[model samples]
Target: MKIQKFGAGVFTIENFLSKKECDAYIHDSESRGYEVATINAISGPEINKEIRNNDRVIFDDTELANALFQRAKGFLPASLHGW
Candidate 1:
């Protein structure tokens, strides 16, 4: 994959992930567990309808997280990280 700079503070990597990788991520996330990602107006965790309908998958597996990070590190700018 090639890293392309879009503009200031904007970058993209087209087709960075293969279909198999995406499927694996989804499968692993579903198999592990998923919780409602909605948050309340006060910034607290809440499950309010109409606000959001996405399930957040917490990665308790460091190996998986690290592997993904490492793969993207080469394509991502260091300045855009940890900010």
Candidate 2:
């Protein structure tokens, strides 16, 4: 059986970003009146877990991935993560 990662979908983004840029973006997001939480790297889709939706987002999947999920339905907010 293929050992697939289970929990919530994950995201990969630029990590080594300048503090100014990071802080500015995060601050701007908050100032714009948006809830945000910055965590260490893209771990897993985190927000609500009781939904029982464990999905993986392979952004670069050559097979086109489960197709570009616009809604990422049943998991959690896609852009809720920060730097």
Candidate 3:
């Protein structure tokens, strides 16, 4: 993987995931299905087409999530902003 610093707090990671891995993720998410994406509003979560007109899937796949996180952890700072 190649990591480039575009600016402060901004970066571009190249080849983060292989084509096969990406394809698998797409298949998994599609199998789960999707719903109209929403944004956090002042009141609460709501759909706002003007802000975003996209679909997303909210599923619980702890194993997959952890695997991805581990893969990314190697490329991320150990801590951010003292957190």
Candidate 4:
């Protein structure tokens, strides 16, 4: 017989990245030949400082960053945030 828990390991595990690489990719996309504007890095109400000055949102996780971008689509039409 065998006993197990669903999502057992995943629930307790977390993934993170080193700071160096995290910021590196962000700085790289500043001038990628597109109409770039305000960019910010934030968590779900976990944003610490204002990042309006930034033009590339770099996060420790790629998927998480993408999710944020997708959710921001509602406000993207304005080309600015902080309403």
Scored by lDDT, model 4 comes in at 0.43
Name the best candidate (by TM-score).
Answer: 3
- Report the Cα lDDT for residue 77, model 4: 37
Q: Candidate 2 lDDT (Cα, whole model)?
A: 0.44
- Tens digit per residue, CA lDDT, model 1, 1-83: 86778777777788878999889888987898988787767877778768788878765778977987998888766675566
Error of 1 at 44 (Å): 2.8
Candidate 4 clash pair list:
none
Residue 11 CA error for candidate 4 (Å)?
A: 34
RMSD of 4: 14.6
lDDT of 4 by residue, 1-83 (tens): 12232552222112233467558655655544333244334533333335433233333678967875675444343532444
**lDDT of each structure?**
0.79, 0.44, 0.89, 0.43
Clashes in each model (backbone N, CA, C under 3 Å)? Answer: 0, 0, 0, 0
| Model 3 TM-score on a 0 to 1 scale | 0.80
Q: How good is model 1 by TM-score?
A: 0.63
lDDT of 3 by residue, 1-83 (tens): 99999877788678988999889889988998999999999999999999999999997889977988998888888888899
The ten-residue window of minimal lDDT in model 1 covers 74-83
